[model samples]
Target: MAYHRRYSRPGTNRTPTCDKISEILGSADKLAGEYSFGGRADTLPPTPGLFVNGVGMILLPLVSEHAKKLIAKCRQSRDRPNMDMGKSWLQSDQVEMKNPSWQAGMEKLMKNIARGTGYMDIHFTACLTN
Candidate 1:
């Protein structure tokens, strides 16, 4: 299973950055909303045998949507200083930072995208499995 999320500080971080998250969330929400997951929201104790690959393939559209959003969010704070957030957004993670100009929050956003893409690819493949 794969899940992806994006974050944006509309005013504190940067306009471009927040705009990117909005763009990605828009695409992902659209795809996720339109694509049926083949299970009800309250479907508990999922039947193990209900492994129809076709059902999983439904999330591919959303994966791409997520990646796009991730990249956009990562690139957003490339020009802002860490002080923009009034606190150090820096993190201990290496990939947590993308470009020099990217704020700490943006770095984390990039990492999220990288991680999300890997999951998306794996799930997408699982969906294609026959």
Candidate 2:
């Protein structure tokens, strides 16, 4: 069985639940939110289990979104960063430090997606990021 979770969400990881969640996820089989294993907070299937076979298929939506000009341009920082509590903003480095669980989940997701697309020649590399 496999489990998947996304870390990049608003107000997510505000509390340091990563360690505890990792512990529980490692040992517990009857988990509450194991997505790949079919556990979900919502009863509905998380995804329709559609099989996507190519990298182009995955990139189409992202390219379409970008072409639509949906993404906002970032303002320049001059010793002033946006600090609205309701807003989520960070650089790549900050995201790695502040939202490690999300980063790990993203890495796992990318690996899975690559494998699913049949375009990946994966070699498992063991290393420590932190």
Q: Pick the candidate with the highest TM-score.
A: 2
Candidate 1 minimal-lDDT segment of 10 residues: 121-130
- All models, RMSD in angstroms: 22.8, 20.4
Return the clash pairs for model 2, or none.
Answer: none
Query: For candidate 1, what is the lDDT?
Result: 0.37
**Which candidate leads in lDDT?**
2
What is the model-wide C-alpha lDDT for candidate 2? 0.38
Predicted candidate 1 versus true structure: per-residue lDDT over 1-130, tens digit per residue:
2224445545665577766766776676434432322323222222222211212211223467544443343322334545444332222221222224334434444444445444333322111110
Candidate 2: Cα lDDT at 114: 49
lDDT of 2 by residue, 67-126 (tens): 333223222343445555322222322111223353455466556544544435664333
Q: Among all windows of ten consecutive residues in candidate 2, which has the lowest summed lDDT? A: 49-58
